[model samples]
Target: MKDKTLLFINGDAPKSLPSPANYELIACTDGAFHYLKRMGFPLDKLAFISGDFDSHSGSDEDMYEEKFILTLDQEKTDFHKALEIIQDKGFSEVDVFGGSGGEQDHFLGNLTVAFAFKDLMNIKFYDEFSEYYFISNHFTLKGAKNRMISLYPFPSVNNITTKGLNWPLTNESLSITSRIGTRNFAVEDEVSIEYESGDVLFFAGNKEIEYPTIY
Candidate 1:
């Protein structure tokens, strides 16, 4: 069965938007709603807009009153709160846009949030350059020929093995402070990765292709 995916947009506006038809539900942070509105996105299709609404004017709030979900918690980011709402709505798969770009710290914070929820749902981030996510201990990627792939350890990951890459890893370790596997290209149509411990953030080149859902 096709996965019921949620398309969630974050604060940093994406350069391009994906078709809403591909998602079972669509949502965005209030900060992202502005960009979507300005870009002529069909706001009527959004399931809800969640955020602190600090940047929103009174008129903006009144206009989107019904769809606005005021998240007042100062401790969490809009992206984090939005994800919580998505999870509460029983969504297990999310395709995120506008998670990167803007402040670099926010990008890192977004990654941290993603890592925290990795075990709860299948979350994939799509930027202009790549689609990244926390991969399972053993993962396989298809239709990856000639595409750039990056394996980055969140702090550290150990005892990794890989195949179908130009430079493969065999029982190797990657660390944030030490060695990381980045800028590697796929040499075959399929790639396989296995690891024993810790978390690995996998990055695959952002190109349209016919591949099954493997998350």
Candidate 2:
């Protein structure tokens, strides 16, 4: 049986929330739970709420005590600790929301955390503007015609090649401080990307496209 995806909400609070019915389980950090409650999200749908509970009051704790997961590790971010809980629960595919807004450093920190767990699970991040994730060395994206697509090297990528983009790369090298591929669009329905080494972050424009099933 195919594992149903886990929907995780972070602290930043997305402009919109995805339908909970699409996922097998729904979870959020304490920070995100506040926004979700204000937005009238059904708390019963959450499997567990994980965080240090620094912002939660006594009554708040009393109400959802069974669902609260106290993660007091000061070394890791709540986002990171939450993923560890998900991993322990045996869910490998996760769709994250509210990870990109608020503070820029937090956004970058979320990306860093996602990168750390990329090998353990399929983690995709969604925001109002786009859905992005770390891609394997070779990836094929479909239904991307006329949409903005960005292939960014986390730090550096080598011997990169691509097809079906308006401006394709062939055996090219991209580095963060040197050269990175961004603001590129797909001209065809399908796009293929291959690279010899290093990690690549793929960003697909969220407008007009159904949530991609290819992931």
**Local distance difference test scores for all models:** 0.86, 0.86
Residue 166: error of model 2 in Å?
0.6
Q: What is the model-wide C-alpha lDDT for candidate 1?
A: 0.86
Error of 2 at 176 (Å): 0.2
Taking all chains together, each candidate's TM-score versus the true structure is: 0.92, 0.92
Error of model 1, residue 68, in angstroms: 0.7
Candidate 1 lDDT score at position 77:
83
Q: Which stretches of candidate 2 lie over 4 Å from their true place?
A: 208-215
**After superposing candidate 1, which stretches have Cα over 4 Å from the reference?**
1-3, 207-215
Q: Lowest summed lDDT over 10 consecutive residues: which window, candidate 1?
A: 206-215
Q: What are the per-residue Cα lDDT tens digits for candidate 1 across 1-215?
A: 33555555554677788888888889888888878888888888988998888888777558677998999998988888988998888888999988888888889999999999999989999888899999999999999987889999998999999999878999999999999999888878999999999999999997644443332
Candidate 1, residue 33: the lDDT equals 80
